[model samples]
Target: MFEKIEMMRMARALGHHASQRQIAVARNIANADTPGFKAEDVASFTDSYRAASEPLRTTDPRHLAAPDWSPADRRTLAETGVSPNGNSVSLEEEMLKGAEVKRSHDLSLGIYSSALDLMRTSIGRRA
Candidate 1:
């Protein structure tokens, strides 16, 4: 199955991360006027994927075990600095983030489609 492919999995993760980041950007834009609201941002997909993809190693049994990892549970953190009204959300920044997320999402979909095409070609099927 294509699920067994590492590149496929990575592409899926990239799409998911883009979705989550888009949600954060939406929330930031929606709460731009709220008092004492801080802008929220998701960690970059590259960093998160790198950390999750790395193999865990334990030199000794005494070492604390690595906990189960899932990108779905990644915590959204507040962006530093705030305006005079104590709200950190910036509409301009959110717009830029939205654009970035869109590009990432598109890239992921392209990767997935290309990989799928390759798979089909390998199986003697036309894509």
Candidate 2:
């Protein structure tokens, strides 16, 4: 029943997006010293949400529907600059991204908690 709620869906999506970003940042940091390693990042949450929310269309009834997107499916980010070693991961930039992910994840959790409180109050339960 709770799964049908739009707020819950959004909260879940936000959480997933943050988690994906964290993983990407970590991977970038881990490969900072590797030669020829390019940094990758997931699409913006807004883009992912818009794509996922689009109505599904199938030209052939026998064809299976497209699967939902997960955070692990990352796209290569355009390089701002590359070191002489051909590595694009910047430790400072990755650290900033990590901090942003942490903030976003916290916000998502806050929203989820608020939604639960609202529901409980609406149902005449103590928040």
Candidate 3:
């Protein structure tokens, strides 16, 4: 029932995306000094949502269907300049990305809270 709500789905997706991004950022920060390590990040939430929400298409009967897309499945190579030692992670950039993830997660939580409040009010419960 509640799972069918588009708003709920979107909020869940946003939370998942934020969590994945935070993990990626943390990994990048941890590997900042590792030689030959490339920075990795997930695609933007909008892009990931669009991709994940897209209907799967089958071009041929013999062709295997594409796996459903999700926030965790959208890893991308970040283009942070490589250092002389071939490490691509940058502390400043990772910190900024972490902040962005925090903000996005907070926004998702706010939306979820508002939805719950609306539901409670509709049911005559104190919101």
Candidate 4:
């Protein structure tokens, strides 16, 4: 239920999420050969949606903290540079992530087009 709703919300952005994800993946791949380059991953907007969807149960008035400090704060990229090289980005991982992002993006566009086509047909019938 949540995944579908999140995907629908993403639909409104017209593939923005997928595009940004692709860009991030590409950046990671590009920096793969560079030294001290940490791979950056795209955060799923669905996480925020899920957090907002969950019912908040506060036992006390001060139970709820600031929204910014919420545990649901999405962290996409992993922290690197604990070592000297600081090169955490891996080409293989970046490529795989990129492929997945591309597939999802294509699927999203297909769904969007189909929905638009259905709307067109409905209007045409009315006419």
Best by the lDDT measure: 3
Q: 105, model 4: CA deviation in Å?
A: 0.9
Candidate 2 lDDT over 54-96, as tens digits, reads 8689999998876554555546684659999999888888888
Give the least accurate 10-residue stretch of model 1, judged by summed lDDT: 66-75
Clashing pairs in 4: none
Clashes of each: 0, 0, 0, 0
C-alpha lDDT values of all predictions:
0.84, 0.85, 0.88, 0.63
Decreasing lDDT order of the candidates? 3, 2, 1, 4
Query: Who is ahead in lDDT, 3 or 4?
Result: 3
Off by over 4 Å in 2: 60-69, 72-74
**Which numbered prediction scores highest in TM-score against the true structure?**
2
lDDT of 1 by residue, 55-98 (tens): 79999989986543346666566666798999998788889889
- Residue 65 of model 4 has an lDDT of 50
Model 4 agreement with the true structure over 19-94: per-residue lDDT tens digits: 7777777787777767777777756646654565567677888785534213232437755442357778867667
- lDDT head-to-head 1 vs 3, winner: 3
Q: TM-scores for all candidates? A: 0.83, 0.89, 0.88, 0.62
Give the Cα error of residue 119 in candidate 3, in Å: 1.1
Name the better of 1 and 3 by TM-score: 3
What would you estimate as the lDDT of candidate 3?
0.88
What's the true lDDT of residue 57 in model 4?
A: 72
User: In model 2, which residue pairs have backbone atoms overlapping below 3 Å?
Assistant: none
Worst 10 residues of 4 by lDDT: 66-75
